[model samples]
Target: MSDLTRKTAAELSELMASKQASSVEVTQAHLDRIAAVDGSVKAFLHVDTEGALAQAAAVDAKRAAGEELGPLAGVPLALKDVLTQEGVPTTAGSKILEGWKPPYDSTVVKRLKAAGIVILGKTNMDEFAMGSSTENSAYGTTHNPWDLTRIPGGSGGGSSAAISAWEAPLAIGTDTGGSIRQPGAFTGTVGVKPTYGGTSRYGLIALASSLDTPGPCARTTLDAALLHEAIAGWDPMDSTSINQDVPPVVAAARNGDVSGLRIGVVKELGGDGYQPGVEARFHEAVELLTKLGAEVVEVSCPHFEYALPAYYLILPSEASSNLAKFDAMRYGLRVGDDGTNSAETVTGLSREAGFGDEVKRRIILGTHALSSGYYDAYYGQAQKVRTLIARDFIKAYEQVDVLVSPATPTTAFAIGDRINDPIAMYKNDLCTIPSNLAGNAAASFPCGLADEDGLPVGFHVMAPVMRDDLLYTVGAALESALAEKWGGVLMSKAPELVVNR
Candidate 1:
């Protein structure tokens, strides 16, 4: 029998329908895992245990009533702290908003609930999703399940870690640059960055509005697709939400395969920046794809070299504008409440006290970049660079089906290694930011274990805009081939975390 904790959400739904297990039994199993291992992993910021159990009871009642059920009916899911959940203290891992409960749910949350996916709780994230590692979280750092002291990637680290640690079977995460996919690679799980506007952003706390995208984080591509389908559709509230109809992702995943498709390996992304083991694994995955009849060849998107610099300029410029609404007098944590304070004082004090170093750094950089005289030189020039990068991808797509590269330039680095060096941390997302800026869909799946530290390495697959299904097709082909070649799944290599039941 499959381990209840590790069963995919699809399996849980099937089990619930067959009366083989109750939703309470399954949801509690995941909740129990969180209670057991989360002290060290620190994956969750807040878990709604009563709400979760209550929802589980409702799922049971539905089954008892013989009503029609959704595909994700009874599956438990974790939300990134950046996404708002109704009546839940949605602290985006920032001390400034610690106790602020949102009055409504993000559209993604609404859809997931409609699908009957139980809310396991909110996962930790970088304060305002500013950093590439969970170390930037105002609450606390999340430990990698593979190696407790090592880092799990962020700003989606909590959602990534939860799945890796078996706290939940599925979760929602966002990617502004590499937040979702890098964390997935670091934690040995599957993370997808859907095409820009593929999912609605109605209530997700804005973080670089142009690049932010919410998608699924899970242990397998099929699982990710199942979750992705649950929340993806046209949302009138979000002006950017694509109006084009998306076919059922679950059906696509069930039939996914890339037997004779073309795969272009990006020539520029991985070089001196990559760890030797990561490069080795990348090449190994390529060889397997070639063997599986993918027409693998090197393709160049030369402007990719300038993506990091451009991303830094554009993301903060947009973020500076997007995050302006959280003034203390209006919403979020407040300070200077001696009854003698003006609105401005309370807002200033609250932000000054609550934001972490990284958030403050970006805010400063953004304010400078968007200032009167420097706007054209910095922000405007960066948009020109963004145009060039997008053009580069558009030109290259004319000759290939999808592109490949290392999801990150390196495997997960040790904790505190890049903390003091802001540029070093930014460099980690060099390969990922390009996809976000270009508004294309991408995914990162485990290729193999790195030889040096024995950590997992992820191979990135990128496709043009609105072609998210292409990611799964190529991803499944590579995943199946790599697993067969490696003799097992990457999580099989993860060392067991000893915990008392």
Candidate 2:
């Protein structure tokens, strides 16, 4: 790997601006990194070498012409496959949309291009972004870069894995529950789930319309903040898009000050069930914040206990409705249509053939939840609980600047450990579900490695809606404090991946 591959997005941007490194050089380095290690990491489903180089060349051309460019002009990024990119194959890690080339660019893609960021290619994800572990992905699972045997986290694992493996400095991810943040924790990277509607959802394939949020993933808080600003803002195309100005996340990340900041530790999110190492890192992170001039207090979000059940019900209900479009009538994989089968039979068979087991399970659960006779008992009650979760956040925010907890109950587990246990897989998102239910801005940053398993542990932060900057303020502060204590970033401790090539 070239030394260029180790540079953060910010450093790369500065190097390109100073005429020390051309965009093509930066882009090609990442492409080569992907080729060298993807067989083991399996982070990307596609690598657009030609397209990325062409984009990089264009940036170089503008620079040679003395034209002004965006702040992140020459940076290379891995895009999650769920977002549509014109003329690019977007499978969303499912057979249903296999080899499907979208006709239009998603809003996020448009913004990223406008910023002059090179799109290396799309990373793999869970089939329709359903499960908490990448094992559910139809294409294949993304292995954790730190340990090849452990999982990299699901739905957006490919995105985080790419960043962790140093194949790309920045990537995009969508968080329905804890997809982005949980994976970031597992991979020793940074992931942010902006407040619901904080980023446009127009181009993102819907898993749960109300809960799905597209956000940034990177190796550092400032890098994630930079991408957040570039891709976030009002989108007339998405009704749920927030019209307000993008939060000052970059500034907050750079500020790295938690002085006088009030931090609340969620009582329901810790103790019993949580692995000892995970709890240890979470408490240490809290103590570090206290020592850094922040006042820390234990805050109770009583309804948070119901977050998992409510999220399961609500997400599937919306997912069942959203995925109905893939009935093989329009575009994508169609099965059992030998010209003799009826349309209904084709739709049924196509879905049966296209969706993976986890996706099928969610669709069935969601359909049952939304059935006319059972809607009120299941989906409707889940909504009521969702409202209470939001209320808990409102009351907590009134007393504290932000909430904190461990991102996941345990560190990355062996790939096959939870593959057969649906209940065990679902529990991975226990600490992350409340943020999704409340529609708040939340993020996960590596706190330290677990003592028992020697895997990365994550310190999670939650902020009120639209107060996305607070996440960076706390994350950057802790990240800086911890880095100084260790004399380097936590990722320095990650076991090196042997790249064959």
Best by TM-score: 2
Report how far off residue 457 is in candidate 2 (Å): 0.5
Question: After best superposition, candidate 1 residue 20: deviation in angstroms?
Answer: 0.7
Model 2 TM-score is 0.99
- Cα lDDT tens digits for candidate 2, 137-193: 888899999999989998899999999999999999999999999999999999999
TM-score of each: 0.98, 0.99
RMSD of each: 1.3, 0.9
How accurate locally is residue 123 in candidate 2, as Cα lDDT from 0 to 100? Answer: 94
Query: What's the residue-level lDDT of 253 in candidate 2?
Result: 93
User: How many clashes in each candidate?
Assistant: 0, 0
Model 1 Cα lDDT, one tens digit per residue, 1-501: 456887877788889999999899999999999998898889999999999999988988998999898888899999999888899999888887889999998999999888889999999988999988899998889989988888899899999999989889999999999999999988888999999999998999998888999999998888889898888889999999999987455665676666677889888987887899999999988888888777887899889999999999998888878777778766777889889998888888888998889888888889999999999999999999999999989988888889999888888888899999999999989889999999999999888888899887888989889888888877777767767876877776778776756
Superposed model 1: Cα runs more than 4 Å off: none
